[model samples]
Target: MSISMKLSRTLGTAFTGLLLAAAISTTAQASGDSVKLEKQDWSFNGIFGTYDRGALKRGYQIYSEVCVSCHSLNYVAYRNLMDIGFEEDNVKEIAAEFEVEDGPNDEGEMYLRPARPSDRFVAPYANEKASRAANNGAFPPDLSLMVKARKGGPDYLYGLLTRYQEEAPDGMELADGMSYNEVFPGHQIAMAQPLDDDAVEYEDGTPATLVQHAKDVTTFLAWAASPEMEQRKRLGIKVMLFLFVWTGMLIALKKKIWAKLH
Candidate 1:
């Protein structure tokens, strides 16, 4: 074959491969989105929205009491709890509940000490290997950015939490030790149903239903993922107002100049 013909054939083959890959990717994404997620009315949904402090606090309680056993919040500090409405003394107490590995002392030994407000949230396991070993070779992902990490955000999380099935559908054979979840991509998940009716008693008199637990925890995770969302929205509103005012002034100034010229 001539050089140009050979080159043309190679280009055609590459183009075909690219088209095939694109089709496969699109099909996979469509399949993934086929599972319709149920949306909840969140407190922080709109431009003027802000995090609900009550929900955040409840979510933290649920996370601390249950989810903390498997998942870690690596990015959040105990001090961050104060942002969600906990008092400094309460935060200090919460931090003291967990032990963290401190730096090497003059004796050149790493020592265990109570976690402080400045310290990051402690992981349940020291490392990935240990975490997987404890959970039957499945690694529990960190919850710090989970709200943002998943495609449907809080909606996906809420569904995953509340959509657990006691048994898999009649035809499907589930893998050993895996629980059926309607929202999970494969319909099988390693983590069993975490919430039950009245799983965490609410100190604030909120009903401790399973759905409430899911909602509160989702709200908390959303806040953890974007603690600055409220501030950002506030700043954005101010900037938009300034731009509107500036544009109005410019329009008035233009009219005045044109009138004087005329």
Candidate 2:
């Protein structure tokens, strides 16, 4: 091809790519957030607070396959997962997926025990291996409550994960040994997109796209932040009811007490 023709072709390809990406982002944005959680701050109140279980389960699968390798959720317990709607039998079965060293038979000797519902989810690497791997020796953040901690919480969490380009943007500085993240705590984060299109199979009907994974995982993190989401709504209703009744009674009492004076 002539030099001028080649240049034109390359520029056309670049423009086409940009337009396609914008179209996709626009469509995903239009799905209309199902949960009422704010998109700009990391609080967890929302319409359902509970979303697609399939999404949560897919997120758990992704975490196990990708994220758990370098993070920890020491605050979580297997039993606490009853809140996730896991039955007792399944919880124990899931917990037993790991082995723990427990004091043997009250004799003060240690033995390997199957993890229980009360046991914390295990970190993938013992310690040093995890540190050497990512985030410049900083442990990859335990994502259990990540959505809650991040501003824009769920929406930002989802957007950041799925929004990677095949290469870093021009003029961006990524250290020789580090990676690029456009929207991380420092913006010069050590982690890259741990997830992207077709990285894993989606058991849920959610399309096997990067954004879907982000949405699913964000939903899972939201659940971890407040497993009592349903309860919070129920209690909110009860409290509002009690306040209404009490206020009415007080108004009636004031009227009765002041009848003669009035």
Identify the candidate with maximal lDDT. Answer: 1
Candidate 2: tens digits of C-alpha lDDT, residues 1-262: 9999999999999999999999998888788443223253323445434455677677776776777767777677888777766689988998998888777667878888899898898766566555666456656767678767876777767766755445567887667555555455444556666888877787655677876667767777777766778777878878989999999999999999999793
Residue 144 of model 2, lDDT score: 71
Q: For candidate 2, give the lDDT of residue 7.
A: 98
Best by TM-score: 1
| Candidate 1 structure quality by residue, lDDT tens digits, 1-262 | 9999999999999999999999999889787635789889999999999988899989999999999999999999999998888999999999999999877999999999998988889999999999999999999999999999998999999999999999999999989899999999989899999999899999899999999999999999999999999999999999999999999999999999899883
Return the lDDT, model 1, position 22.
97
TM-score of each: 0.85, 0.72
Colliding pairs, model 1: none
Write down the TM-score for model 1: 0.85
Q: In model 1, where is the ten-residue run with the lowest total lDDT? A: 27-36
Query: Which stretches in model 2 have alpha-carbon errors above 4 Å?
Result: 1-48, 104-109, 128-130, 133-136
TM-score of 2: 0.72
| Per-model tally of clashing residue pairs | 0, 4
